[model samples]
Target: MPKHVWITRGLAAIAVGGLLAATACKPGDGTSGAGGELDGVTLTVAAKWTGTEQKNFEEVLDGFEKDTGATVNYEATGEDTGAYLGPKIEAGEPPDIAALPQPGLVREYAEQGALKPLQGEAATALESNYTGYWRDLGSVDGEAYGVLLKAAHKSIIWYRPSAFDAAGVTPPETWDELVDTTSRTLSNAGITPFAMCGASGWTLTDWFENAYLSHAGPENYDKLADHEIPWTDDTVVQTLTTLSEVWGEDDMMKGGQKGAVQTAFPTCVSEVYGQEEAAMVFEGDFVGSSAAEAGATVGEDAVAFPFPAVGDKAPVVVGGDIAVAMTERKGVQELMAYLASPQAQSTWAGLGGYLSANSGVQPDAYADEFTQDLSATIVEAGENVRYDLSDQVPSRFGATEGRGMWSILQDLLRGSTDPEGAAKALEKAASEA
Candidate 1:
C-alpha cells in the first residue's frame, strides 16, 4: 500500500470576530493572492506517507499555503497510524487533520465522536468533485466526515505481452476462458500458468474477492463484506470452488503451491517479467510501478486486462485513502477542501504514482497513457465499484498477522484445507472478531 502526506506552517492568531468573518468565505470566493482570510491559521496533519509520496504531497501543500496563507505541520508516521494517534487522541491533543487509509477506521473514529463533520468549503468541494459512491464511503450515518484523497484500481490482471504471444494466448474474457488459457499455457509453453503470491495473504484475498464479487453480484458482495451473509453461504463455497480450479491444480502455479507461499509480491512480479518463469499475475494497477522497478517495460513487455468476468459483468474493487478532519478550525477545513480539488489531485497525479477518484481531474494529468487509460477505466466503472472486502472488515479478522485471511488462505493453497473448511474457518473468525 502507498501513503500520502502534506505539511504547512501556522499563521498568527486572529480575534474571534475575525475568525467568524473568515469562516463565511467559500472556496474560490477570493483571489489566491497575499493576505487571504486564513493567512494566520496553522494546522497539523499526520499520515503514513514518506519519500516520494511525501514529496509529491508537499507540492499540493505548497499550493494550499500560497492560496490561503495558512501553515501546516506534517508528520509521516508510517502505517501504524492508529498506534501513533491513539495516545494523542486519548490525551486530548489529536492532530487537526489526519489522512486515514481505511474506511472502516474512518467509520470507527466518526462513531466514537473523534472526527468532525465536513462543512463549508470542504463539504462543497467534495460534493462537486467526487461521485456518490465516493461520498458515501466517507460518510457515517448520512453525515460526511472524510474525503477520499487517493485511489487504486484492484481488478487488473498483468502479464508480459511477449510471454502471451510466445504461448499463442490472448487475454481471457471469462472464468472458463481463463482456466482454458492457463491449461493451454502449461501444456503448450512449458511455463507456469500463474504467479500466486500466497506469502502475502492480502493478495490471496483479492483473488477470492474478485471471484466472489462476480459470482455473488454486487448486493451479496456488500452483504458478505458487512458480514450480513455468513461465510458458509453457498456463494462463498462456489467462489472457493471456482478459485480451486486453478489454485488446487498440480502445476498451475509457479514452483507449485509451495513456491507461491514462499514468494513475496515483488518476487512474484520478477518471476513473470525478469525470469519469465510465469505467464500472468493478478494485482492492482500499482504493479506496473513494481514491474518497472524490477526492470520490466510496463505497457510494452508488460500489459494488463480487466480481471475476467465470472458472471454477467466484470467487477472493480478499489483501495485508497480518505482525508478526515479532527477539528473544525477554519484552516483545517480549508486544507481539506483544497486537497479534494482537481488542482491538488492533478499535482499529485503528475508525480506518476498517484490516482484520484475526483472526476473533475482531466485525463492528461497522468504521467503516461497506460495510467490515463487505467484511470479512465476506474472512472467509467462509476457506481459499479466495490471496495476491498478484507479492508472493510474488522482488523482482527482482516489485518491481523498469523490469524486472519492471510494465514487461512495460505493454508488452503498449501493443500492443508479444503474450500468448505476454509469457508467455515472464515465464518468462525468473523464471528469472533
Candidate 2:
C-alpha cells in the first residue's frame, strides 16, 4: 500500500489498542501453571490487528495461553508485515506464527521454506472447519501452511433502502439492472447513485474484482490471479468496458470523478450515512460497521445486497487473515489447531465487525441478524467463494500506488484510461511484478 494510504487504513485500525501488550498475555493455565501441555514453551506471534481487532484477537490468544500454560508474546506489525519479517527470516529468526491477510505472502514465505507446513491436529481442524476453496487458499502445492482466521465478505454493495424506495428502484440482480438502478436513482431521486472511493486504490481494486469475477467467471478469475492468463485477455477489457457504464458518466458518482479521487474511504461511507452526500457505496461488509458508526441503524437505515452478477453467478470475493506457522514447534502446532477451532473463532465473531470462514462457527456467533445472514451467505458459498484477486497476486502488482492494477483502475475511474489501455497497463505491471 502507498504510505499515505496505509497511514489512513492500516495505521488508523491499530491506533486505538496496544499489542494486547505482549507481557500481559502469559502466566497460568489456571489448572496447572507449570504443568500444562505447552508449559515452558514461549511463542511469538505477529499480525496487523489492533484496537478492537487486537483486543478481540487477544481474547482468543488468551484462551490458548490459559489452556496450555504457555507464554505467548504479541507483536504489532503495522503496515507491510512482509517487509518487517523479511530481515528476521534472513537472520534465521521468525515469529512462531504470523497472521497475514495476503495469501500471496503466505505462498511466498511457504515456497521460500520460511513457513512450516501445518499438519497433524492443525490440518484436521482446518479441514473440518473450512471448505475446499479455503483449504486451497492456505496451502502451498499440496501442503497446508496456514489457517484462515477471519474473513471479510467483499462482494456487497451498501445503500439506503429508503433512497431506493424514493427512486422506485429495487436491489439489482444483474449488471445491466444495476446500471439502470444507478440511472433511476439519479434521475428520480436526484442523488448520486455511487460514492466512489477512488483515492484509496484498493477500494477500486475491489470494484474491478467483483465485476471481473462475475464477467470472467471463477476459472478465468483464478487463471488471471495465478498469472496463467495475461491481463490483456478479452475478459479483462470487457469487464473494464462494462464498468465504464458508471465510471464514464459524469453524474453517476457523488462529488464527480475528480472529487472521488480525493475522497478517502471513510468519507465515502460517511457520505451516504452520515452526511447523506450520496445514496450508495460499495465495498466489503466492514462498511456495515462504518455506516453504523455514522449513526445509521444497520438493516433499517442502511442496507446491502450482493454485487449483481454480470453473467450467471454472483461473485463472493473474500479477504481474510491467514494464520501461518513460521515454526513447527510443539507449542506452535498446538496453537495452530486451536486457532482453527470453532471455540476460538466464535470468541471473536461475537464481537461484531468480525466474520469467520469456519463452518463450525454458528451464525448466532455474529452479533445481529443482518450480520448472521451475511456470514451465512459467505460460509454457504463454500468452495465457490473466491479470495480477493488483488490479495492473492503479488503486492507490487496488487497493491502499489500509481502503478499496477490500482493505478490502472484508478485511471479507469478518471476516464483517463480506456478498457484496452487499462488492460495493457495491467499486463505490463503483472509481468514486471
Predicted candidate 2 versus true structure: per-residue lDDT over 1-433, tens digit per residue: 2111101113223421321111121221011122477888899999988788888888878888887888889898887888888998999988999998799998899889899987767777777667788888899888999998989989888887667667777777788888876555565568778888899999999989999988888889989998999999999999999999988887888878888777878889999998887788989888977898899987777878778888887888999899999986768877888888777777788877788877667656677766766666666675457889998888889988877888888888888889999999999999999
TM-score of model 1 (CA atoms): 0.91
The CA lDDT of each predicted structure is 0.79, 0.80
- In candidate 1, the residue pairs with backbone N, CA or C atoms under 3 Å apart (3 or more residues apart, or in different chains) clash, namely 8-71, 8-72, 9-71, 9-72, 10-42, 11-40
User: Which residue window of length 10 is worst by lDDT in model 1?
Assistant: 2-11
> What C-alpha lDDT does candidate 2 achieve relative to the native structure?
0.80
User: For candidate 1, lDDT tens digit of each residue in 1-433?
Assistant: 1011000011112112222232223454222323567788888888888887788887778887887778878888678787887888888889998988788989889888999998877788788777788899999999999888989889888887777667777777788888977456654688778888888888988998999988889899999989999999999999998988888875888888788787888779888888888878889988987888878877677778778889887888888888999877767877878887777887888987887777666667787666766666555565568888888999888876688787888888888899999999999999999
Off by over 4 Å in 2: 1-35
The TM-score values for the models, in the order shown, are 0.91, 0.90
